[model samples]
Target: DLLTLDVDHLVVVTHGFTAGLLVAAWIGMPVASAGHVAFPVPSGSITTLREDGFFHNRAVVTVGDVAHLVGVSGS
Candidate 1:
């Protein structure tokens, strides 16, 4: 379903563990291989996924970036 979407960019918000699975799926990695992969997605953190050109352009731009929370009281 995700691969069929015709959009230049999309946003997905989900739990940390689920986020890792989504990333693995987006990059065509085997689900089994993702078993050991961990994507740190703390509350309010941001992750970025990008694709460019046509073939083999997928990329993980950022993982759990909380720059905006740098000065937050509870961060």
Candidate 2:
């Protein structure tokens, strides 16, 4: 999956690594990450995860939600 965030003159970009971790957590999967990896992207980046819960439950978690992009146009 891809994640994007728009913040005025700057746009944040990040890979699915973090989001994947969230998914693993939600689905009871084994997750491993390297803490030494540096994030060179902007701080305003947003990542969203959609997953099915136990007993047919549904959940959505937005890390760094992009509410600021509302009504904005272009990329």
Candidate 3:
């Protein structure tokens, strides 16, 4: 049922900052410039981007989703 969806959108969330951005760039997607933020995205972090089309625009929905670790320790 998780694979069933009625909406037309694409979501990409992957590890490796450069690799993710590079793949998106290669596909002609507009990507924001990477910055040296004070807090870097930790390991196991999630970076999500959503779009309606594959070869068009995509917007970030959420980054670093740790909700799955709500009741888990050392998350």
Candidate 4:
């Protein structure tokens, strides 16, 4: 599977009406991730692993943060 295509800034976006979001949060890779919704928090700030069970949320540099999901949306 191309899921491990080997790239930087891997993102996975899921519609507000799907379970994809939960799955993504459960398993994040690399070192950055976030959650986005249509209303209130249109986009979640980038979060990075911080100290002891903490992560720093910041701005996302690219939509690639998970647009790839759109391609497999129907599946």
Best candidate, lDDT:
1
- In the range 1-75, model 3's lDDT, one tens digit per residue, is 422566565454555566455445534555453232222355666656565466756555565666766777777
Model 4 agreement with the true structure over 1-75: per-residue lDDT tens digits: 434455444554445433334344434522244345312222432322212224633333333233444566452
**Residue range 8-57, candidate 1, lDDT tens digits:** 77778888589888878878889789988877688888889888766758
Q: How big is the RMSD of model 4?
A: 11.2
TM-score of model number 2: 0.28
Q: How many Å off is the CA of 10 in candidate 2?
A: 27
Ordering by TM-score: 1, 3, 2, 4
> What alpha-carbon RMSD in Å does predicted model 1 have with respect to the real structure?
1.7
Question: What are the TM-scores, per candidate, against the unseen true structure?
Answer: 0.80, 0.28, 0.44, 0.24
TM-score of 4: 0.24
With candidate 1 superimposed using the best TM-score fit, by how many Å does residue 16's alpha carbon deviate from the native? 3.0
Clashing pairs in 2: none
Query: Residue 20, candidate 1: how far off, in angstroms?
Result: 1.2
lDDT of each: 0.82, 0.46, 0.53, 0.36
Query: Which candidate number maximizes TM-score?
Result: 1
Off by over 4 Å in 4: 19-75
